[model samples]
Target: MGYTYPVRHQTGTLTTEQLHLLLKNPRLIARQVASLTNEKFLADYLLSGRYDAAGGGVYYETETGDLYTGTDPEAIEPAGDYPLIQLDEGVPSAARTVKFGQGSVITDEKISREGNQYVQKALMRVGNQMVRYVDTVAWGVIASRVSSTSAATSDGVGAWTTAGNVLGHLMTVREARAELATGLDLDTVVLPSAKWAKLVGMLVDDGALPREQGNIALSGTAPVSAFGMTWLTSPHITGTDPWLFDTAQLGGMADEKLLSEEFAAAGQTGVEASTTRISDNDSYLVRGRRVTVPIVTEPQAGVKLTGTGL
Candidate 1:
């Protein structure tokens, strides 16, 4: 015999079966919101990859000796023995994955009055808030690791507001890149939204025409490339200065489980969701969560600009 769902006679009063069915569309909407919000997060760009493990520490290599020393075998004499070099095995470092989540309650009264629109809005808000919370956590880890302690003070270029020497700043970034180990370059620069606007305005005033200028003018927040470095802006990074780093070598994200098995099965990897019906409250509780941690493997791979005067 087929299972029978409870019938609803009163208008706007959803049955148990109808409530679960209504959750489907709202859940999809929530996931969509999360996908859009994820694009604006700097953590996804700064952190290169994901480390999957239930529990334990992660290890990463540290640069010690010159990696570009001798490439040609002909350089070594046939009789001479090859020089033995010791590699620095990375130390074990671990960060416990913390759960970030947000809950939204869909009461029958509200659903009865507001219908599916209310449910969609509530669940979408939950998704955005949960993802934003996780993003803040990831950025917190990155900020703590890539601090301004040893940052380079902007020389020649004064505050960006006064049409500061943009080329001069690029030169400084080039010099910083030259100082890094072989095969590593500071190809990414992150700026605050306000500072990025100043940068765009400065460029426009200077009559400097970049390929991305059109898009920048249209959106006022698009990432642009200059001097072989991708310049990005994020609301999460609030400061007058900028951060330059090698995205490939800096760090990564480690997650015990990005999503529950059910969510993974549904192809939603970063955020997980759960639903529960509250008997006493006559409502359904929907929650979204993320379990992850950002790990800065190479602190030296990036630097925060200290006295940019922006």
Candidate 2:
């Protein structure tokens, strides 16, 4: 078989600095997805754990003291320390890479009529897709863990269309946390868009009152504060089971950071765009990968509000 000479060889023309600049788009994509994934849920509140350490794993010890008693009138015997419950969880790694051909690299039109910009968008899209994939995996892990054990169900009053019902459901979660000896910190609440739409209407009472009183309204995508915890919504999550958990104990862990790489086809040459590669046909190939794992160290730290209806 004989090989034909390509129409353009742009990759060889890119400087090291230019390549690095091209790589920045993938990073931006990663950041955007991170905001939508577990990072947003965990960073501000949950325990980071020890997953960041090389050869990832998290270790924790549970210890308690026993009450001391003695029959002697003035002397009391010392009580021995309770046995420690040591716990450890290994973090698993995940990876992905997406590749596109040359036809997409040179021929497709991007924002600025520049071929390189089109490749940048393509690579960034790969990064975004990777984030969504990992996010779903992480949440699946959480859901599985919750399924293994019983989650505190909501009172069958109704959906959160009323203030009383919303508070009642959250209170039930607080009680469940206490039953597990977990403190009532209630750090975060995540609900599906369906449930969140119902919750936002509950910010203020509809009761008619005189004009002098100031009414508070929540705006934008900011987290809502109720039942002494922050509340948020995720489009990725489905169903009406709202997750109420103490982020200090239950959250996500990563075994590795986001990874990115670009390779030029063999025997290919010319100016390569920032996030592009010259294929055998003189087009570009875009590729990316991400490594992560989901962790739920303490099941009792999370509570899911089960739904009966809307």
Candidate 3:
């Protein structure tokens, strides 16, 4: 005779049946937390260009002293030798591209007890951290390359906080930048959040037009276009100084990989993600990574205004 084991039926203990029912009907509470917005990232607006390779280089042409001199054709006799105009290649430069990332781990036991909530939250947090890191790096690159500096009060104009010719001061800087041979139109201005607040407040209090005051009032901390330039504010810009530059010519970012989650079907180029299982720990490791570098190709294209405020 063959040995046989008894088969279990659905008629289990009352407590076990109730537990199964509860598990099948879970109460809906709320949706996952919203992700952060990218509005505060200056890199998105300042840096330009993209590269697919791991590491690359940039070149800036050296400005000649006679760049502004007229080179119009002059009348010459037949067969007379014409003046020779010389041209040269740009100066080559390179910036280091390094990987940056953040990671989080989810244990199997947690998933078995709860669900995939932990994993989803972990990924969101990791992505946010990557964005912050990139912005910090970009700011550092900009601060380092901008060697030319000036004081906002240099022309006897009081700081922006006081009653002075704020618009005139900005125009003066813009004009100075235009005077450079390699300069582009200074269309962008970056200020710390506090300084920006002070500027708007002063303008509004100083009898600004009703329409302008209303616009400023409604645009709480968002970038506003005024004084013929786009004004941007960021908490990451710790100093009281401001930066004026042409975004197109200031610099660029070498983005080798884009930020993406593991198992995501669509993404290309700065940060990426990977998942791995740790057998010993009985957990899954999720990691986010990015490969990029911020480079200032034309240092002269940007000007840093120091002592802009009291």
Candidate 4:
């Protein structure tokens, strides 16, 4: 309870200085940081260090588990103004950025002092923000070339390919950084494979969309809806499609009917890629300066979830 929640921008186009200010904002700072419970936890434990009692007393156990309570905290994530790669802005008279360490912890006031210390240290701790500006001409030139996107920004359809997969990515923010952090100038985004995995995990963990079943496929524009939230073409979505689901999945609430009524083979198959093609719409990791996250509170709790045939 005494610990602080250190919010950070994992990797965004946002600059270091701007991120600090964003964290200090009235809204962001005002957002309450509470000691919540992650009822359904996804985690791992590690022993940071341990010392045994030489006197034959009880051996002190330093076992630590990284538990994802699955209860994602609500944060008023930061945002930045202007473009990330606006070199035409003359690379500015000077530039800056901030780096922050990210992680979380649980608290147990009713427990012993040692447990409290663990909770205190583990509580949402923020790291020092490292600031960096374009130092070299090449870096500056490329930064200028992109002209307002994030370093990770790239080009693609800017649309969803599959319904379940797409929605899953929208759920959890992550242990590292908020995708839409302050200070990003996302006119030019470069999607990385690591980020894609994160995006996919965010969706799956949230239950908005289940994990990839087998071979992924796209339906012929069926009126797809999840949890009766909205209507969009279900199955697989492509960047070429004009419609962009608000906050991803056709609806914030995934349709329960599909899992109960629909056929097993509705979406795209998890086919291995054979074509050595590098096309924007081919679904490779593209840059993403920032993503538009909508206000969809209250994630729908589903039935006794069990799975097989992995």
Task: Give the top-scoring candidate (TM-score).
Answer: 1
Instruction: Give Cα distance to truth, residue 229, candidate 2, Å.
Output: 1.2
Order of the predicted models by TM-score, top scorer first: 1, 3, 2, 4
Residue 255: error of model 4 in Å? 48
Q: Write the per-residue lDDT of candidate 2 for residues 7-88, one digit (tens) a residue.
A: 1122223344454344345443333222322233322233334353234333333212111121223433587454444333
Which model is ahead, 3 or 4, in terms of TM-score?
Answer: 3
Better of 2 and 4 by lDDT: 2
Local distance difference test, candidate 1:
0.61
Segments in model 3 whose C-alpha atoms lie over 4 Å from true places: 1-40, 55-88, 108-120, 162-164, 207-214, 258-269, 277-282
The lowest-lDDT stretch of 10 consecutive residues in candidate 3 is 26-35
lDDT of 4 at 121: 34
lDDT of each: 0.61, 0.45, 0.59, 0.21
> If scored against the real structure, what TM-score would every candidate get?
0.76, 0.59, 0.70, 0.15
> Which one wins by TM-score: 1 or 4?
1
What clash count goes with each model? 0, 11, 7, 58
Candidate 1 lDDT, tens digit per residue, 85-125? 54555656666777667778888787777775676667557
**In candidate 4, where is summed lDDT lowest over 10 consecutive residues?**
39-48
Q: Residue 304 in candidate 3 has what lDDT?
A: 83
